[model samples]
Target chain A: MATAGTADSGSTVPTGTSSIRRMAPAEMPGSSSTTQSMKKTIGHRGVETTTGETTYKKTTSSALKGAIQLGIAHTVGSLSQKAERDVLMQDFVVVESIFFPSEGSNLTPAHHYSDFRFKTYAPIAFRYFREMFGIRPDDYLYSLCNEPLIELSNPGASGSIFYVSSDDEFIIKTVQHKEAEFLQKLLPGYFMNINQNKRTLLPKFYGLYCVQAGGKNIRIVVMNNLLPRIVPMHLKYDLKGSTYKRRASLKEREKAVPTYKDLDFIQDLPEGLLLEADNFNALCKTIQRDCLLLQSFKIMDYSLLMGIHNLDQASRERERGGAASGDRVVLEGPVTPDQRRPQAQKSLYCTAMESIQGGR
Target chain B: MATAGTADSGSTVPTGTSSIRRMAPAEMPGSSSTTQSMKKTIGHRGVETTTGETTYKKTTSSALKGAIQLGIAHTVGSLSQKAERDVLMQDFVVVESIFFPSEGSNLTPAHHYSDFRFKTYAPIAFRYFREMFGIRPDDYLYSLCNEPLIELSNPGASGSIFYVSSDDEFIIKTVQHKEAEFLQKLLPGYFMNINQNKRTLLPKFYGLYCVQAGGKNIRIVVMNNLLPRIVPMHLKYDLKGSTYKRRASLKEREKAVPTYKDLDFIQDLPEGLLLEADNFNALCKTIQRDCLLLQSFKIMDYSLLMGIHNLDQASRERERGGAASGDRVVLEGPVTPDQRRPQAQKSLYCTAMESIQGGR
Candidate 1:
């Protein structure tokens, strides 16, 4: 019954001159003057000229991050109070929102964040999905909020921002409102697929949160980082099985670790990847099933994110003192016996399905 | 419907010679030979003579602490999955148990601890109670398990071990089996009183856990620490309002920061505490309500744990470079303006009723 923005405005932070800066047409592409004026009139008190632009930007960014963390922590923390039953259809439409005022009281002390509104969609469904994926609440929070997330360069043409958790265990990607709505509608089937087949190579979404701050809505999805951090990826590819415009851009190919597409893959490996008969069958079957599900939902333009780790190349890099340029070596301390065993047993070529997401 | 110990014994640690040492009559007072032999024969494989007494003890202790932390973390983390409704009568009888075998697998990895059994009594009701007390689940987990609990010297004759949270926000006290059972039986009424009277001075019991390890059942109750960590207490007292043998022993009086008894309180303050008329009435009403509730349950031998902070002495101690030896200065670094406000507004004589519990 709690529709978004229907609740009483708990508290509001004066928009200040920052709003004007944000309303700059050149800065916010595609934002109309009408939308800017509407936002400016909603809770505008007066122009705050004393605060510098840099200070205002820093405060907003810090507050935005803090609000996101607090929202995720609180939502996940309260998951256990719900019944351990299958999520209902209505759950997909359910949205829980909490408004945090800038000025806090005894009951709600002012945390590190400023005024912001946080909303979580289909909390119960997400909770079940997270549990099915073996994601514990405490572990989730410790991974996401224990340290500041490392911002990753957004490589997509959609201009969406991306952040990787400090532990490299999860990725928080900003999504458009339409994409979020689509994901919500896809939940029931997604849940069923995961429940039936644990080996499905789909993106494992742990949570979805929307932080509304400074007259902007930032929606983010918390998903498992498919690529293993311990292994240094030698080659990466985004395969769509399509030939038309399915190649990396010239600029993209110049990057240190470019995501080579179908054309590049065929040219680089003329024979293609060799796998055991059983593994090949399993992989094909899973991909077929996943594609069928996505097609049924009228979803297209999805690509399989893949990472390849070459054992020989990794060993050579190790012998050369450390990983090669552009290769990330996350492990800090001396390798333990347990970690060493995996490296030793790894074959010449190891391919991993990172994730499956629409819009590449 | 899962009765305690009815499920398969997941895995257990080998008792080894440590069990024999634990069976020493001098160390385990009132433990009968029958109980000891019964435990030994139940899982007697062979005596681990190669492992030294010190090493075995360290391992068991570490495992015990680790198990306790894991149990608390897992239990609290899973609370939100339950329905957010009024607890039912059957909830009081509900007990959830988990067994951590020494040898863990892919599903349950070997963490910092070894084999142990953990039982949580009326988890749903406790979760509700904690929510009512304004304790967030994430905050609870952080305070209880973020770091090692500081072991406190037990002052009671009940032989209950005590541990204070690293943040000084909570106290974990080991309770006897009978006491745990009594508390479980008293839950319905306790819940009602606290629900009706938010100002009740009764002990804020957040969690009750039973850890079975080394052929022993250790029950612990997590409660509010009562004393403010920021302001050091200059004096402390345990008042039962009874005169018969209600005096601190010579040995107890010799220690610095000794918990003065009813007689010592009377001798120290002949005129007794002087409070404003409104505050006095409110305090009397709350105490009376709490006492009536306890008496209705036939619970007796309760005491009010009180701490007093003296501004003059605190200032003198501050002037002398730091706090006196007896006082604990928990806050490090420069004091924030928010924290300093309390000290400035505090009256000359500040009295706080930490908690009221039976068998104090």
Candidate 2:
């Protein structure tokens, strides 16, 4: 988004320049990227990037023009509704603060979900910038927020204080409370419970605490806030409707869109999804971890079938035991044959990829 | 841990029938008070708790028998060694399991970071029990494991898991790498990173493959398999060595010998250290969840002139803004001369209570 491409270098523009490139403003001090694409019919903002070509654009006043286009009628409405003429108007302040300075990229949308759009600052990662904030996960600004509803000009960094709404009040985030809860404390405690810990069932302690925001309110939430556990629901190749057409014009592309109604859903998945060795290893770890927690929590019995590593054990203690990956153990629940598959698949378990087929 | 009088719930055994109590196994089950206490004691195995003015009874062959009766040792060296062995072995197995059996009160040594000692079985919340396993955290178990450790028992509603682990060479885990180059994928992409998480640092996602373990075999570690980023370093808490006492026996209590050396390197913490709120609402949530992790990880951010809560702006804004309870967020950074006084003692920086003299 930098203008000179070297915008941070503080390069200057020719004084009498009248091209689509930019120079820093004397008053407001803003400017960026030299758009060098061929121009056709331009929009209020800049050239609409319908095609894959870049458009050359003059930076000054461009952002302002774009904002005005969206609210031209509204601006004119506010101008006439003002009560005082002498004092600077509140309408001016609102317009100038947000609309005119359209330089922030954090506000850009990247993807669409049902009824909303998503703006990802980055692919979700370990210790995201959001964690740096003083807020709990449930109290984060975007947890349940719809992008189109909020007027956000900036994406706050991890520790940067931002406002969030919970129970209808705009509160700030300050703490994490996972380990403190009676039920949640085990999240961390279980990690140290075993040596050579192979598998554990208890979720780990992520963190705990409270967050303060919007001047003075604190919100609390348990953390290591769980992510959506996807269990692969369904998948299939989709080539239907107008999808077979190629070399379609933009108008034709828009008109002949294939919809979800055209797709099929699977009733259930097959058994023994264990494919590669890594997959088996992961399942073994999970089972071990699970058994460990079940024992600690008092819900399950130890089973040789749950061994995480057993390729060696199978050969040695062949009589006393079950399966093993290496030394890791796995729980051998009854294998639902093609006969039991119907009932079990009713539970709706599928492999990860199948579940992601067209994002079922 | 609570000082309550015992009610004979048809479970407490009479003095001479101690063997019957052992034979009965979970006769008394878990004490009820811990469930009501602020900090509930949870464990991998079951525990036997004494709630009220408890009658003391000792088991004969218990590995802990020697340590419990320091004076009755046949050979101080062998018995003490045996006791340590038994306790450690039992503890390892118990902690390694999945559920926390409602057990007798925690007989944890203050110096040891663990709170619950494995002894007998007890009750627990079942749904969370199932879900904890259903949505177990990945941070607790690493995939580089060569085998899965197996479980032996489950406490069920009664509590505690029965599992087996032997010094005999048995594979506890398993791993099968995809390739040698898979290890390269464990690190972060040029733009992505694993960053420090809870108990373990999130490994940079390299690649996935296989490794050789045992004699000739396969083992694997799925890199970047991180759960919600956790700050494990925050969970640690360091205390004076004097706090490391075993539950003082009646005779030892009478003798009143201070076994631990005084910490000349550190001093007695001020009374504020004793001000325990049921929940650390005043601290930022992330900081609190990481309270244990911080200590465990040694990621101390506090400076000499500052207190832990000072750096929390959200807490300050919360206090200045006001919401609930006595959890006031303290402000950090620069203060005016009016903020200080001549006759004052400091506590971990500028804690208000640290001032010896009250200021207007």
Candidate 3:
């Protein structure tokens, strides 16, 4: 989740020699080749890079990525066995610290050291989530974590990187220490709220870990991908219901899959979607309760991430043998008419039916 | 789930000439040496063999066992990919059917050629269960299923064979077609009930598959073992809440680890467990709801499987270095005083806190 404070106040795209200078690797220590390649790759794919290494280095998750991944693998593998199955209970979430001492090698400096520690706040509470969300450790460890990680050109606020698991079942995002601590503090209450009310549009948090590497305290949290795993969203919006700087920059708008904000959303759909009486009341009640929960926690500036997938357009595009990209993308496999009955109606995202009453 | 139709009326322990007649493998055209070996191995482990070849062959799961196992592996593997992640929904759950054509045999009669087919019912339901119960398919298909299937002389009703997964996380049992059909009919209702209530003492059902092999239709259902995975139960009772012929026979009791029934439980625990007012009320409500669910389905003669693990006696026996017998059994690893707080309270079987009153 990106913070509102991190968004650029004045949008200016860096390019040419300035971009090349920003892409230099040796300037930063412990920078992965993947991130270097990602900037150039996304640039070629026609997405402008805003946050450079200088700003990114201040709050980097790169150093902690490998360590957190290993820690998760080790903890999950150990806990998966019969002897330690119950060890995943609420209090038993803290594992022994994993330390990688400085090797004292010729090229490497002695001051550099890496250590990782992970804690599961109310793991038993999250176990309920594991049941409902299907984010089991096996799915993460075997199906996704075991494969090579792919770092993407993140659409999130600057200085943050997002890594999608090979199977795209889970997302690992770098969070500032303040956000991590806030989540850790809010977890128990968040869990209680979720346990009581199962219908909410809030993001599902899975695991949290902190890494001490490259003289930076990088905090990371693992969460279930908010986007539908099977259905590709043709359009996405990050709406905060606020007017101040609530529009995507021109550079962000250049991306094939840019996240539009509240102004753009309002401009496109002047008359909001109309719902049946009962459904409208239920949605209002859910939103009210969610707002109360957030208010109780004194949390603010959080946005409601929304996605829309046009089924008919997706089907027609597939029928025409069009390349899957942006509007033409089809994430889930082909579904026969019979397969798209009541089951499709049950999906959370499909409930966001956009009945565009009038155009912008 | 045990059915009333399968319970035996008589108390005789079928053995001697009857046992020899029952063990006649040549009489059964589709009998396998593998099944024979399994019986012998389990017998050597000190369990008696009352359900021999004659009764077992009549309701054989042998032909379908191999086929079902392979089908599950194939299904889980194929569906484990990213494209199929959402296939595990509330409604969709069947995997691809596996078929094996009959082949002419050289060792036996050509007229006895048998074909096999297997299909898993609503695998998505089981996938949800896998997430909740923490039983990963990889652990089964790779770690346990790849190992040789070891058949055990089931303490269950006669002629029913039981197989424990190599890792002992799951149990596989063969059922008669009638029982299988009854369970299939009950599943939707059963699932709905479980979805609403989490504290019910009902056994968790995982998968149900029917195999047409060995010229016989063998129905198999996989379920989570009720007994604690790590802790040993010195005494186990399968109480049907009925008195008619409910006690184990003399020969059955002669075994080291016999499954005592209703009469045995009553005879031993004349004064039942005492509970606090709130706990007693909650328990009564749970039992009442459970019975109503069963009655609505017109189901009868189900058992409440119980196991007793005396903490103090077990500790004392271990301290004295006693031989591992019924009284001296130890299964749960060393329990520190600190660990005895929440875990001890949460155990499904640990309500054996009847040490408050005088014991037998």
Candidate 4:
């Protein structure tokens, strides 16, 4: 069961700790008195509160959804109105800020949700970037706001919250203030690099928004969800090309869709991923170009998020009544029944660069 | 009883025609066969349609709401993301166009409403104009889109359509293509004049949008609704200062809130509106200044839309069980009980410029 406040509070659980050790009843924060007080508060608000964790999750989820909906609605709507143009130095520095007051009028209806301050950085630049990536304004809005986004488990130690668009086409991740600032500064170069090389493996940044609510600045970046939703991934890895502290913890490995790190990848796949000669050369060239650009911006500690869909394993599982152990592939689209073919030899590998942090 | 296709079709009913003439059964278009076919179509679409007029009105209203919602969403969103700047020469010429396809994605969900091409003119200039007018973005959006706009009976011979915002704070009118063009060209001067004098009686243009649907270009301009919804206006006039053809038709006089003309003013209130010396001087000076500005731009045929709230009449109505015949005062805000005072002799007068047509 998910713990209350663990997702957003950044409360650390010691690495490699056993489930029994982590769940010591004496260490649990919910005492009988605390529960009684919480029940009273919930009653006063006229809302059902089954548990503190559930309430916190519901509040965070609703708040995030409201902010994202309004922010995307405004951003995409604005982009549709303006002409596409070259990114200027001023564009990089300019921030468009709007406050949705609690007491709104007929034209701007008051959302019962908490008041929020939404700030968009380099809107014009982002508009152009989205256009280059073949994303339509309406499509962008519908993806982010048409339905409630699915909250994904956050595997990163930064305690960042993750949400995937209902269609699994986009991922919205809350980032630190420094990360948001760095992304804004990196925009000019990112735009140029994307323009030069359309095939680069760099993360496709769609929008950067800072939603200030409850006196906290929650910065989020919208990017393409690299993994295909329908594909059954047998294994996934976060490869940083480093050895030190690059390992998945015992607790991390217990999750259904555990993202093993560099050390795990090295131990599990000793022979490494084998690719066709042409495909290998193209992948290497794109990665090299992307790294050069990242190095120029002094960005480091980025990892390639790789998902491997094992054809043979998937075929075997399909043969055994379509149930695969430890597989968490989302059944969004139609499954390829052809995966059952024994002649299928290659595993589908998908890789996307994740979390490009600025190096000191 | 609104006739089917009359509101949007621009079909003319001869001036001064009586209700008997309008209701001539032989001239009515809804034959049994036509009604039967319409019912069939409505049934095929699986939507409730009681009458041809209702269906048309609903379609137009929904199309309008969708376009306005998306357009305002885009415009206000864009405005919030941009900085306040001077109205450039190019700002007068730039048109931001966006297409909302029938097949929309998650980000831009498809509405069952018709596909629309929304074009916004001089967005930056309009943004600044809206700011100068003290209209907040959220308030603007909420007023226009939070609820279906109340469609007002179009009194103009030009066959223009008018919709009042739910909050009675905005008037959205469909303008002719030429009028839309004239307004765009007039924006720079309008911006300057508004900046020079904030209290000008000139029409406050909030947004200019052209929504293209069903191969018809419907241009609409959003302006401040000068008439207060809650105030009971006993008499109203549209005075263009021209005696020629400047009389309210018999049909117009039968309406609840009839907009009388110059001839009617001369015939009824021969003494003219009695005002205190100070108030009279200020009104004249403002009108004189506004007229000079309009004349400089070669604009003509603009009329003063004046509404008179009779305090004594309202008091008398309150005394007689609170029902006033022919009074269309919207019961929006709380009624000021002080209006019941028989000693309240002074009448309240409100005046705003209407239909600013450009001279050839």
Interface RMSD of each: 18.0, 22.6, 13.5, 17.2
lDDT of 4 by residue, A1-360 (tens): 000000111212111111112112222233222244244222111112454321222245566667778777876776677764334434666788878776764324477778888889888778767766667677778879887887664423343466788876777766656667777776656755664454565667888898878777777778766664556566767666788997888887887767677789899989888875655665666667666666666655455666666676766776676666445443312243334322221111122211111110
DockQ of each: 0.01, 0.01, 0.01, 0.01
* Stretches of model 2 off by over 4 angstroms after superposition: A1-140, A143-233, A236-271, A291-360, B1-360
For model 2, how does the per-residue alpha-carbon lDDT over B213-251 read when each residue is reduced to its tens digit? 112222212222111111001011112224333122343
Error of 3 at B111 (Å): 23
List residue ranges in candidate 1 displaced over 4 A: A1-360, B1-60, B81-83, B105-107, B325-360
Where does candidate 2 chain A have its weakest 10-residue lDDT segment? Answer: A1-10
Give the clash total for candidate 4. 19
- What are the runs in model 3 whose C-alpha is more than 4 Å off? A1-360, B1-65, B82-95, B100-115, B155-158, B275-279, B320-322, B326-329, B332-360
TM-score of structure candidate 3? 0.41
Q: lDDT by residue for model 2 over A1-360, one digit each (tens)?
A: 000000001111101011101111211113232244434222211233445322112221222122222222222233335431111111111211112212323432222111111111111210122232223333332332421121111211111112222221222222212212322323222323322232222222222222111222121221221111111101111211222231223432242121111111111212423445654555445445444444444432122111012233334433455222223322222222224233323212222222112110
| TM-scores of all candidate predictions against the true structure | 0.41, 0.19, 0.41, 0.40
Window of ten residues with lowest summed lDDT in model 4 chain A: A1-10
lDDT of 2 at A159: 15
What are the lDDT scores of the predictions, listed in order?
0.56, 0.22, 0.48, 0.57
The segments of candidate 4 whose C-alpha lies over 4 angstroms from its true place after superposition are: A1-360, B1-51, B54-59, B325-360
Ranking by TM-score: 3, 1, 4, 2
- Model 2 chain B scores worst on lDDT over the 10 consecutive residues at B227-236
